[model samples]
Target chain A: MLEQFGNFLVHGLVTGSMYAAVALGLTLTYGILGILNFAHGEMLMVGAYIAFVLTSRLGVNFLVAAVISMLAVGLLGWVIERTTFRFARHEHLNGLVISLGLVAILQNIALAIWGADPLSIPPPLPRTLEVWGIRIGEQRLLAFGLTVGLIILFSLFLKRTRLGKGIRATAQNAHVAATLGIRTERVVAVTFSLAAALAGLVGALIATIYTITPFMGGLPAMKGFVVMILGGLGSVGGSILAGFLVGVVESFGGGMISSIFKDGFGFVALILILIFRPWGLFGQRPEREDV
Target chain B: MARRSWQALPLVGLLAAGVLYPRLLPGDYFLHLGIVVSLYIILTSSLNLIMGITGQFAIAHAAFYGVGAYGSILLVTRLGVPYWWAWAAGILLAGIAALIIGASTLHLKGAYLAICTFAFSELFRLLLDNWISLTNGANGIIIRFVPPPIGIPGLFRFDLGSRRSYYYLMFTFALVTVWFVRRLARSDLGRVLGAIRQDETLALTAGFDTRRYKLLAFTVGSMYAGLAGATYAPYLSYIAPDLFDVNETIYIMMIMMIGGIRSIWGPVWGSILLVSLPQALDITPLLRMIAYGLVLILVMIRMPDGLAGFLDRLVSRLRPGGTWFGEKA
Candidate 1:
């Protein structure tokens, strides 16, 4: 029983870090842009597929391919922003709808290219470490370690760097940021890019743990959005915490109950949390709560 | 009176087209496509009332639809209930579910309400999947024949045992749904709902029961969706979670947006165009979804009011001060 408990904890944290990585991006984008990217998961899917192609077709090193995937998807995000979301910056409804459109388009394109089958690459480290009789995969450890490191680096970038501060300032008040000579458009675009990059990075890492598929991003995307809300839309720390919470809930709930309840359980917890705390665990009251 | 008759001229044309569609094509495939279009029109027009006219972005319409389809199908297969009675029961269950979901979540604001309803929808889908004893899990339930028991033995038993019969039934329901929505749009209730949709605070300030109206719109809209689903079960003869999942919900939203959300004819036009586009162009499934996404994004960005709205403007511009085909005043 104790061994199983430890195993579940280990699995949950690894899962939680993946959620956190994407949720961090989602929250940052929402904080700055006031729009949730419904197609964030497709970005993850695209990222994973890119990494897969780079490694298999071009024989790029796995880690190097992951990095390239991150950068490529981030650049793709910038293009998407300019084409689809620049005009829709102020229209939250349009942003949501457009994001969904992007999801459909991306998913269909991926399906066409890859077909509806799951694919996987051999793990970079293919070793398992047994700590106190609880076995953990090296791939999972590497993925979690990278996710945490990047998240910390991201937080610092948002705090200490000039561009990062510009982003936070814009997020705080776009009107004031614009008045203070900060190009809010650049901030929004950069944040969206970073978010997409983070999603891609997580996607590449997650592919190490599970098989990759064109449709794999949908569940994680839903969970990541739920985590964003659970942690509070704009709170980075809250999102991280909530990501773990979701992972733990899903892991333990699926272990104890039926596997089908994994996603369902996470949403149930979200609904309960919402009922009691509409603002979310870490979210501040949005200025316009009427809608 | 003559002016009023002229006002409904466009709708008359629409009615003629709808009635003549099966006759014009007459092939089984075309008739099947017509049934699918009719089903979508019934589904999305109700969605229009909740999201378009009432301004509530509830995404749980598909869940209610699932309830209707599953409920009616279960009653027929499990308990030997007649098809007509099962449909009523299914619609009632969906309405009740809507009432509960709407009452609890209606007071929340836009995105919050949307997510909350989404949660509800997801939860229902989950239950439908897990409750295998009742829902048959993800395998889904299949009803080979509709078994249209007229309830009166001697009143002439109409056998809905073929695709053609199912098509006619769906066509009739589609017409009824369109007619009902048109009447609702012109009624005081629709006007009040529209006002509330415009600004709930202002609507309430003007001494309106905003919550009641919103709930009414939600319940009625859900019932309409339920009716569509219940009718759809025997038409497809197969019911599964995929048919009523989040994807389906969003697809319904897409139809409403593409067809034009604010008008009754929007769903019909949207459904017809979208359902037939792949067939017409021989587009691959992947290419079709990509096109759908493009159209939806373009419409939302350039013409938030939709294709129906575009046509309404064109007609009004063509005939200034005239209610061409009963454009909403």
Candidate 2:
């Protein structure tokens, strides 16, 4: 019983950290832009596809392919913002519609380009390792490490950078930040691009762990959306906390109940949060009652 | 009353066209297409009630559609309930479901509400897919017969055995929904919803509990979608989870957006064009999705206000005294 429980804990952390990676970008974009980009998952899908193309088709190193995929997706996000989303800054629903459109377009584009075949990163890590009855795998450890490192790096970037400060300020008040000579548009664009890059990185990291299909992004993207809502939209801390919490629930739910029920937990959590505190676990209380 | 009669002319004409066009049409396929067009028009227009008039975005509109479909289908199938009562049950269940969701999440504004609705809809879709005992786990429950119309003993029995007849039935429902929404649009509630859309803070300060009004809008809008779905179940005789996915929700939103949200007839026109266009294309399903995506982007960029807005501009151009576009523009 002890050994099994210990195994669940380690596995949960591995999966949880990866979820945090995918969800981090969603939280940032929600914070900075105040619009949930429905296409964020497609960014992950795009990244995974790019990685697949580089490794399988072009035969690039896995690490290099992952980096390239991130940068490429980041550029795609910047272009999307510059052309379509720039006009929809203040109009919340317009942004949602545009992003939702982008989701359809991106998914279809992926389908057209890559077809529906599920791809995977070339196997590099040893399958598994047992340490005192707690089985650990090299791939799981690598994914967990990459997610942790990325999260830490992201925290530092947000904490100790001028651009990060601008992003934070814009999130707090775009108009006020603009009044203070902050380049709000540039900040918005940069933050969006950075968020896209983070999602892409997470996608590549998890590509090996899960089947990489063109439409695989939809489920995880929805889950990430649910996580963002459950943790409180735009709350970074809430996203991380909820990510791990969700992972644990999923781990236990999958173990105790069924895999399908594991996915249902996110929706259940969301409904409970919506019923009790719609603002989320760590989100700021709205000043206005109308919202 | 004289003014109201004149105001209803276009509606009368639409209903007349719906009834007569099947006779003039060349094929059953077009009639089938017309039925789909009218079904979507109902769905989109109802969605517009909240998104356009009340300025609330809901990604779970199709969930209510599914609920109504499933409710009526299950009632008619399992309990051998009468067709009309099954339809009524579906609508009621949809309204209740909407009320529950609205109560929980309507207070959250903008994106939060949108996300919550999206999540809930997805949850429902999952349940529909996984709840094998009840939903048959995605093989979908089938009905033996179409729900016959609820009416008198002999005078006006409805014929739903044919797709053309079903087209007329859905077309009637679509027209009624449009008329109801138009009435609401021009009424006090409509004015308040419009006011709330323009400035919620000001509306709130002006002694309006915007939340209550928004919830009412959400519930009413959901009820219309439910009615659409209830009608749809018997028409199609089958519904998988695929019918009520986020894609369908977005498709309805796109129809409303392209039609001109806040415009009474926008959704009707938008859905007609959108649903008809794909059928007219005669292409593979894969390319159809790609085309749908491209059309959404192109329509938004070219006609931001949608087909209704475009037509309104054209009408304004034709009439010298009318400056609806000018004032709004």
Candidate 3:
């Protein structure tokens, strides 16, 4: 029984890391731009598709494909910010609606290109590791490790880099950031690209573990949003913690209670959290004006 | 008196057109399309009440719709209840659901409210898909029994089994919905909703029970969706969990956005255009959806007010006084 528990725990952590990676991107974009990009999940889908095409079709190395996917999706994010979101930044609701339109566009474009069939790349590390009589897949371990390393590197980037400071400033107060000689537009673009890149990398990582489909991004995106809200929308630390918590909850719930309703657990948690603590675990109560 | 008579003329003409639509087409396919259009009209108009007029962004309209459909279907199929009673019960179930969801989540504004509603929708869909014994799992419920005809004693029996009769039934329901929504939009409640949408805090300061009003709008809006779904289940004869997902809600929203959210007739025009466009164009569903996305993005950027607003502008421009129906540009 304890060994079974360990397996579930390991499984939860691995899935949790992916959720955290996706949530990091979502939180960043929401923080800086103040618009919930409904199409954010589609970016993950696109990233996975790009990597899939490069590695499987063109015979590129998985690592090279992942990097290319990240950069390409990041560029797509920049263009999206400039073209669609830039015009909608002033109207919060309009921005959200525009993102919905983008979701339809991107999802359908993907469906057109890659049919509805689920696809997956050959796992770069297919070996299984046994530690203390507990078995773990190497690919899952690699995914978890890469996610943690990327998150740490990202945190350092935010803390140590000048552009990262600009992003922070812009997220705090765009008007003030602009007045302080920081180019707020540039900061917004870069933050959006970086967030998209994170989503892209996570997508590639997920592709290694799970089959890729046009609609694969929808649920994960919703879970990412759940994690973001659970962690307090703008708090990076909150998202990372909440991501794992949600993952474990979902994992244990599916394992013990009912696997069919596994996806429903996160939504249940989201609703309960919203009802009890609208502000989230680590988030400060937003100012009245912020709503 | 002259102006009042003149205003009534267009409404009368539109009513005549709707009543004669099936006869004029005389094709089963067109009648089928008519039924679908009417259903969407109900959906889009109700959604407009909440999202467009009240300015609350709830995307779970389809879940409420599903509730009505599934509730009524289950009753008719399982408990052997009469269709009309089951239908009313379904609408009530949807209203109750809205009451619960709205009371809990209405306090949140903007994206928070939107996401909460979305989560609720997903939860509802999950339940419908997983509750195997109750909802028949993912295989969906295929409705076999035909609804009995309704009439007063010996006056007139309107059979609902026929396609033409069902078409009229749905059309009449759609008409009632449109009329009720129009009345509500013009009533004192409508103005209050508009005020709340403009500024909830200001509405609170102005002595309006904003929360109560919002709850009322949401409940009523969702109930309209329920009505549509209840009527729709019998016509389609098959109901599935996947039929009422987030994408359907988004489609309803798209219709509202394209039609003109603030106007009563906007949904009418939007639903007609969107429902018929692909049919007329004969484009593949994939390309059609892509076009819809492109149009939605373009509309948001270029014409936020939607096609109805665009037409209103054009009419005002063409008129010498630069006003359409006495509403100022």
Candidate 3 local lDDT, A145-215, one digit each (tens): 98988998998898889998888888888999999999998899999999999999888888988999988
Question: Which is the better candidate, 1 or 2, if ranked by lDDT?
Answer: 1
lDDT score for candidate 2 against the true structure: 0.81
The 10 consecutive residues of candidate 3 chain A with the worst lDDT sum are A282-291
True contacts kept of each: 0.51, 0.47, 0.59
Sort by lDDT, top down from the best: 3, 1, 2
| DockQ: the better of candidates 1 and 3 | 3
Task: Provide the lDDT at B138 for model 1.
Answer: 92
B21-132 per-residue lDDT for model 3 (tens digits): 9878998899899989999999998998898889998889999999999999999889998999999999999999999999999987766787789999999999899889
Q: Which pairs of residues collide in model 2? A: none
Candidates 1 and 2, the one with greater TM-score:
2
lDDT of 2 at A120: 84
What's the lDDT for all of these models? 0.84, 0.81, 0.86
> What proportion of true contacts does candidate 3 retain?
0.59
| Candidate 2 A-chain TM-score | 0.94
Worst 10 residues of 1 chain A by lDDT: A282-291
Worst 10 residues of 3 chain B by lDDT: B320-329
